[model samples]
Target chain A: MTDTSLIDTSPQGSTRRSWTFTIGAIVVGLHLVIGLSTLFWTPYDPTAMSGGRLEMPSLAHVAGTDRLGRDLFTLIMIGSRIALIVGTGAIVIGGLIGIAIGLLAAFASRTLDDMLAAGLDILIAFPTLLLAMLIVASSDGASLWTAIVAIGIANSAIVARLTRILAKRVLRMDYITASRISGTSWIGVVAIHILPNIWPTLLVNLALQFGLAVIAEASLSYLGLGTPPPNASWGRLLQEAQGTVYTAPLGAIAPGIALVSLVIGVNLLADGLRDIADPTRRRRR
Target chain B: MSPLLGIESLTIQAGGKPLVSNVSFSVAPGERLGLIGESGSGKSLTALASIGLLPDGLQASGSVLLDGRQVVGARDRDLVPLRGTVAAVVFQEPLTALDPLMTIGRQVGIAVRRRAKRDGHPTDSITVMGEVLDLLDQVSLPQPQRIAEAWPHEVSGGQRQRAAIAMALACKPKLLIADEPTTALDVTTQAEILKLLGQLVRERNMALLFISHDLPVVAGAVDRVVVLRHGSIVEQGPVATVFGQPSHEYTQSLVAAARAFDDALEIAP
Candidate 1:
């Protein structure tokens, strides 16, 4: 047998980290810095009609101005913050609910497990956007938290399905039996063995879910069922800029660029994380 | 002495079809019993049912008494206390038997801590680690400290099996059910693991239910043998009586095959 100890003694060996991870991290990091900076400072007030309307990119206004004369750059920066908030919030809510349901399904009695599996399949098959729209339309109309809750609930079905499949696979392994035979409780088994083994894959899936959540939030905002006025959501900016696109394209283009970059960054990060988290993939490289 | 493990007419069914039909066996305290069966013979299922660890969709009927506790139809919570304390199992594949994400030491430490808590001894991290190393040493693993820190993939198959044995030993179980523990190892490693298992069982006075398909291996480890075919017990007797003068046709064929293989090995240039 090949002795892996010599080469793979350290968990975080030098060759394990790849350039894909580096680039993705940098891109995500840049967005995070720009987004977080908005909490303390922005060059121009994002909500104020403080510049010449429909101006092109120039020294006075970096990304130019919107039809309402708000600083496009400031709005884009705030959009980053909103995107991050919605993504993080949605994942947290989705992950907790999904993981709990998935684990319950995994450890549940045969009849209950089947019922949960069928329920989850139906939920997964339903369109996420349509579900989000329904949720937004039903209760306390679209604010930031409402949009977050809607997207989060929409995201949970997919997360639950993935978690269920992954958890079941982990559960089938002999170690789980060994754990139980070792007197570890079911809760302890989940906490110690099942979760730790499945988290890397789950984490990669959650990162992709984070990207979807951002896009879903943007879509909701565009439909006017998301974060309302003065918040300057990228989708809201796109909606307002749709009419003035011919005269001034930057208004539409700036927010679109911000949204695309963040999503792409997240996707790349997920891809890189999968490569890093899986030792087989790392070894192959 | 009463049997540490007693299975009387155990029947395991999946999807209303019986997989193991009316199987019966008993293992007395400190006795070594070999369960001999080929793949799909339900030996593993019988072992699992003995501890109430049978997979979902497979229903077990009849009595499985482990240390006087009813394992058949027993609630998981009720079985939890009995497992690890009464009996601990070392599975066939050592690599998959251990948690890949955890270091060998930590996994063994969990068992050690559980045993300590059950015995109402000190369960602090330092004491647990100390006991973990002790178990590793008891398994005769070279450089116990290094083995403790190693991941499952980092070690050889034998070492991994040794570590798995260490984990099983950590619980200080009265009965050690080895379900083909040495089957996944190389020929040399298999012999070493079997030797280690025999020595440990002897040293700790733990009853051993050694399950395997290899006739010679089972004959060497166990005093008595239970031959199973297609989930049914064909014949069972003292290892010498059964292997020397087989009564059942299946057992006779098995003995013949083992003898043929042994002769082939002896004649090899």
Candidate 2:
């Protein structure tokens, strides 16, 4: 133990810096709670629609009614569930796959690194949405889970590429070399030394992926490649609103604003994290 | 009695270039041998190659006997069980040698527990951690308990170097290959570290292979100094003899350079 390692007990120690991380964690926690709650609860049969069209905001139907006569606010909340689930699902699925492939590729050598980087170069060159749509379209539409799986698989490629690059860079650092020479097994070196050091980078990437997943899920839903019809999603609402855009116009605008606002919140949150969690940026602060 | 480490006809190739070629050395028990050479003269490479840590794309070949058993050309995986047990190396840059993420106590405790195994019997791990705190105190680290919780980034350069030394000592290694351990320290700290290392070597009865470019530091440390030039030993004898009357032309030039360096540093203040 060295005296220098003692944490400062001043009221403004590491706690202040950890505040944003705490908030971000809560936001993500709420996302999971709200997302999981949908498996059990909802205001109404969201797709029931009361068999009527073009209704206004009322106690019976708060947040008014869409052109398809669905509850607006309830649908938005439910859409929140769908967005969070698909976003988390895709990012996690792709994130794990990416991390495994990346670590292995990076540990292999420059030849393997170049091969992976070249493959990712081609993947990154293509638009992510377009790839998701292509895969989702080719799959059977009756199965909503199938769409998520397709999109999730498509998204994993990018994450794997990113993790590979991060692993490669981390492997070159002195701590990693030292760990290796200390006779730590390669797996131990990767798990303890290499992974912990790159965690901030991984967290930032996770945030970025969460935002992208939300938009991608929305786009897929909007194209009728997302959560099945009568299954209340903002993307589905937007799709149904296309016919009455000239009429209520509110239906079109509501889901549109909802999509943009949610995406904006996630992006702002991710952007704030990107600035805060970054060691270089934190050092500047 | 077998020497702690035996390097016979060792060669190292880095990026298609021979860094150290056909080098041989040995460290008898309780004996300190200095491998003295200027930068790029391959002394450090030879030390690293003995421990199988020359980095990627660099290759080491020939017989390396630790405790008189062959380890040269051994796979990296096979080397894990031997580190700090048979041989431990203290690198040139201690600040980088210790992980920035781990505490000094934790780092030393790892090696201490790993090597405390006795006759293949089970051992209590926490007992070794307490011993690690003692070693931290041994290295003159103030506030041993709290210091054990802190990261490497929090320590000063000299303190970090001492902690690195503490880690090397944790496993009670038979052979210690220190590659210029005091190069990064202040003169006062350098002198203190040299004296402390010298004392520990005699107390533990361990073999020491000390590598350095500075003649004065080496002069104060090892019992016998082996001078190298262009990947070959140019002089080998007692440190006093080499410093007082060098036989090889290269060794004489090095002695002259060392004298001039001391004179220059003396007048600078």
Candidate 3:
């Protein structure tokens, strides 16, 4: 009876199984290829007015031309590159600063831990974009580096809060005590035991944060608090395309699709990665 | 010979409420002492205090001298050198005691490496691996090679406890504290672990501080027993005399319970 039921469910079960990771990877990978290829060549100089204004999709001007008379395809390729750069840079900055602060909070004394926790809570309560804008406004003027640093600093509070909670849970386990009793130093315990145990979860969160950073960067650019002209950030493309939307609808829709797809791809990737990293969850399915 | 562990007027408190109050006891070198109590009686807290490993927000007052070193109120840094050298602990739950991510061999190897480095011995990978396997073998774990390669979850409870014992013994500590080490195992596995622990302690000539709620298990493992009730010592004496003729009402009740359990087992067809 069990065998027959298992056989009947096999085909349906295979269909029901998740394909998010594969789809996410493919979408992200396509964007990456387009982004990287821009380093070597683009059909035309993205910043130059090489095409007629508001040209419809054609072999010469695929994705058409924007109001500025530049190839929309070239603008999007450059936009993908900037998006990836900001995502990678923000996540790197956030991961280092956040993990360090979180570990410190986990190991801190009662009073100190409470102070740090409260401080992190306040930082987290602020909107990421607003916080990024404040940072960007305060530190010189808006540029690619400024936006990256601002978004990173703004995102760190959430990451730190997550790391602290996870590290504290790991700290309470008996193996930690056993490790200590075995003469492992505090630093050694953090590196060997705490970090390895918590990293799988952290990796998933960081992937999600990557998507958020991409969106945050675009938002900053849209508000003119991001990279200046000629950089062609997706947010700027969407903003620039808005005036010409009725004449060349593709101009506005192109960047919008790019932004949505990247974020959705990363979110799906994170969801799939979680299942892969956690064996118990995989076994349950 | 000097006592390996001496606790005088030791009181452990959490949030200002005393959990183990004014608990006093001493264990001489090469002696086997049992701390028997019911759950929440503070037996585990006493063991933790001895090693200066009491959990956060819990403070231990008074003196706990282990190998002539003060454990009460000692800073963690000050206690590091003494840990796994002067004394080591085997906690109750073996599955939780060993790191889930690490292999049994690697965990044991870490302890061995630390001990070797402290003693100024060569800490090459080969020497450490050899020592890890030796310790696993000493614990009588079947196929030390296979057991060494297995993760904690892959092994049975009894094997895990044996591996835990091996990790503790890796330090060659002067004092070994087994805090309800076999409580999580079945009756058969418990007896086997108790036997393995007894053999290891005898072989090393290390002082043993066995903590358990099981009266029969404690009686079989130690020379003297300290009975704790509500975080205080109700009675303490040689196991034979204490079990044969108890003085405190609490001690008498504990003795009666053990006897009743044994009687039930004997009458069962």
In the range A174-274, model 1's lDDT, one tens digit per residue, is 88998899888888998998888888888888988998999999999999999898887999999999999989998888899999888888877777887
- Candidate 3: which pairs clash? none
True contacts kept of each: 0.66, 0.33, 0.51
Model 3: per-residue lDDT, tens digit, B1-269?
Answer: 77899999999999999999998999998999999989999999999899999988999999999899999889999999989898898989887888776778998999999999999999999999999999999999877887777667666788888999999999999999999998899999999888988888888899999999999999999999999999999999999988999999999998999899999999999
Which ten-residue region of model 2 chain A has the weakest summed lDDT? A1-10
Q: Which 10-residue window of candidate 1 chain A scores lowest in summed lDDT? A: A1-10
Name the 10 consecutive residues with the lowest summed lDDT in model 2 chain B: B114-123
Error (Å) of candidate 3 at residue A134 is 2.8
lDDT of 3 by residue, A41-122 (tens): 9999988998888888999988999887899999999999999999999999999999999999999999999999999999
Off by over 4 Å in 2: A1-19, A141-143, A242-285, B117-125
Could you tell me how far off, in angstroms, the CA of residue B100 lies in candidate 1 after the best superposition? 1.3
- Which CAPRI category fits model 3? acceptable
DockQ of each: 0.56, 0.41, 0.34
Task: Indicate the residue-level lDDT of A95 in model 2.
Answer: 78
Per-prediction TM-score, please? 0.94, 0.88, 0.91
lDDT of 2 by residue, A1-285 (tens): 222233433343234445555565566666566557777986766776763577766788766787666677667778888887777787788778778877878887768777887887787777888877777777665345765676677777777787787777777665465455456688888877777666667766776777778777777788878888667677878887788888767777877776665565565556556545443344312
Ranking by TM-score: 1, 3, 2
Which is superior by DockQ, 2 or 3? 2
Global local distance difference test of model 3: 0.89
